[model samples]
Target: MQLSGLAPGDWVTVQARFTPQAAFLVAADGRTRTYAEGEQRITRLARALRQLGIGRGDRVALLAVDSPEYVEVLLACMKLGATYVALNFRLSPAEIRTVLAASGAQVIFHSARYQEIVDGCRLRDAIQFESGYEEFLAGGPDGGELPAVTNDDDILSISFTSGTTGTPKGVLQSQRMIKAITQSGVLELGLRPGDLIYSGAPLFHAAGFGHVLYGVARGGASVIMPQWDADLALSWLGSGRVRHATLVPSMIIQLLEHPELAEADFSGLRSIMYGGAPMPTSVVRRMADVFGCDLHNGFGAGTEAGGQLVLRPEDHRRALAGDEWLLGTIGRPAFGCDVRLLDPDGAEVPDGAVGVIASRGDTVMSGYLDRPDLTARAVRDGWFVAGDLAWKDQEGFLHLAGRADEMIIRGGENVYPVEIEDVLGGHAAVAEIAVVGEPDPHWGQVVTAVVALRDGHGTPSAAEVKEHCRGRLASYKVPQRIVVVANFPRNPAGKIDKLRLRELLAEGRIS
Candidate 1:
């Protein structure tokens, strides 16, 4: 995959010239665009943005739901060498303002539904999707020369973190990073020409954008879902048009619970890639039985780092056949990436010893935008410390222990939540589980389990749940208290929000 002189936007132009009539983007509402058509639209948008005084290094923020226009604006920014900032639609006005101020975005492009939010944020030079956006494009010359974007080091996008722990920081991604990610996707995810990729994940995040970019790089068509709808997803799968797709565990659970899943035709589906959370082994097996397609579980790559590791389809098969333990592994380091398990002092830990997960590669972000101190702390000796605690197995598979920030100290004993969650997740009654440390006057922090029971199953007593883990986990790791909920609050990326669970517990709401 020679990517020289081929930024994402430049790749789009190349695809258009070579496969003019090939479908490039299919919107959720049935609108479709060929590669040639998408290129023209992007060119016009780029020209309009340039006319508005946005050029190389200028920050352009977008606050909207997923749509073809969202992708167009992203490509437009790439074409004009402007750094694109994708604001999470679920963020509060204050949070949005903070990110905008940090990025110093010159203009904000938002959907009509977000007009009030955009107004309340008081963003300068905002363009509304309904009329202002079209009018803005109409005012610019469509065929004008775009800014030369030859430098691969130019910042391409700034993706904000999920802010689960604290305020989200803007991750500065360069053309080089995106290109590396695109190639990783092609090589690892099996993206190829003629494959129709369907992605419902929010394009504001790296996972979603990587999906779209992979399809473009492979000259494949992509179906963009504005939002996840289990019924609509089933319909698309049954349509036999979608060859591959990426989904979160929550979405997979919904699909499994949907009534139409049994009747959905998945014979044409080639691969299903899932991540964003730990998946239950039972659910993985059920998906394989139902779809009869390859199931891949992966982790590591986030906004700061591109795809770093992948548990390929073959690994899933191995787990299914009896090495069920492999399902828990995040697989080996991806191509062009180097992963290490390091101690606090930055020394490499021996294999099979738990340590902080760190990676260094072409796909890693340049740095956190404008946070030199944080950049220095996160990227040391050219390696980006992921803050995730994991140990490499003898087989070279990386097994997640938990986030270092989420580690629980119970009666002076260090306990990783994932260890308890993994044990409890296998219980028949538990559908979803998140373990958190609740401040305790005696023990410093008590191990608390917040659980959501599987549908059609009654909630098991806290004692029963604790007894199930008695043999599997250390005594200190067992949940001191279990609180059952209807559902776990999730971040935008569909990962369970442990922070929110702690808040609910503190508020006496989840008891």
Candidate 2:
């Protein structure tokens, strides 16, 4: 039977029964578990959770890094028909309190490292992963039946936004959404059984959680990295055991800069999957040259929607063949998704016209938890829109035009920062660049470029950077002001914090 037809929680049983002894998890610290062992532990954990008074529809929260225990807790929630809430570990105490208060989680599991923080949250029961977690798991009776997963629409997890623009909203992730994403990854992204995968991203984020689940969903093994380390990752990649891996642009950049790039044996590596932010074209090309493997880039998949658009490996090959415009696109609609560019009136926009993205699919979240008003505004009919803007090319590929909220209206003309940033980022001296609109007296808003130059490259004056964009972009689209910086401020989600950047500039922190 297809895994798509079953609840995501049942995927473990399918793999465990069929693949039994196959490795399900391999931690960076040398911890390992086979499918049978993982299933047994998950079953016990489900019963243990029941003993703690957590049942159907109840919420269980986790505040920790990526680990096998994290994966087990998520599965345990699924087995009991409970909702798992993965909170960001990087959040401050106040922010953490805000999320906990909103989520109303019955129990929170934290690592020893976060015991102090969890104590401040004042939960009724805060189980430490290493200290009390094992004891808690052992408390369950050996042979008890878990709840049946009957409803596909049941909330499986609550994923919070990165809070770049404002307070984080809890996006309800359903079992159906997880199943859809799992099927999409297996069919569209070529995830296969027996493929040893490595995903070091934080489990709180969708990509991190999805990558970890994909391995179990496909009867493969996932190599867990508690946190990303370039040196440790390069060694894992060279082991000739890891077939698939998930990384972000920043992680890839660090891996490229590592001295082992030239010596690492990636012969067994089949694909490199990256997402969460835009990748510089230069870095993309360098990664392709160094890794010599299939490159997959996911685009437009947020907490609300699991998988929407994907730039497949073949798309990267085409870009290498001089179809450079393809690199700017996020590829076509993903499997089982309907992606449309719509005007304000909800009508589909014509090709080549910039419009807001509206997606409808099984992968779309059920709704925002406890915010029906906001949910109504975000999801109309069956389509979900989150203010992301893009234009469809003639070949049906979509090129991002920045977020609708991030668009700059310069002198009444709309200017997308992505177009300008892409041109400036290709310059040899620039390592990373961000374009934002600054408040202006006459023009209402002026385009400003914040750039971080590569090492050994002398700083280019504002005029020189502007000159590079002269013919490549229209005069209105060109940046009106330039500010150089050593690095950018990143939000908890690892995305460049443009909102914070604007704040810093207004305060005269960056010149």
Give per-residue CA lDDT, model 2, range 291-322, as digits (tens).
88999888765588877898999999999889
The lDDT per prediction is 0.85, 0.85
TM-score of candidate 1 against the unseen true structure? 0.96
State the lDDT of candidate 1 residue by residue for 1-511, as single tens digits. Answer: 3575666778778888889999999987778899898888889888888888888999999998887888889989988899999999888878777787888887999988888777776455999877687788777685733545748899989999999888899899999899988888888878778688987678998888788889888999888887778888888977778999888888888888888777888989999989888777788888899888998776875798876788999999989999999988888898789999999889999988889999998989999988999999999888999799999988999988899999988788889888787788888887778889999999999998888888788877767876887778877888878788888888888889988888988998888
lDDT of 2 at 302: 59
Question: With candidate 2 superimposed using the best TM-score fit, by how many Å does residue 504's alpha carbon deviate from the native?
Answer: 1.2
Model 1, residue 186: distance off in Å is 1.0
List clashing residue pairs in candidate 1: none
TM-scores, all models, native as reference: 0.96, 0.97
Model 2 alpha-carbon miss at residue 195, Å: 0.7
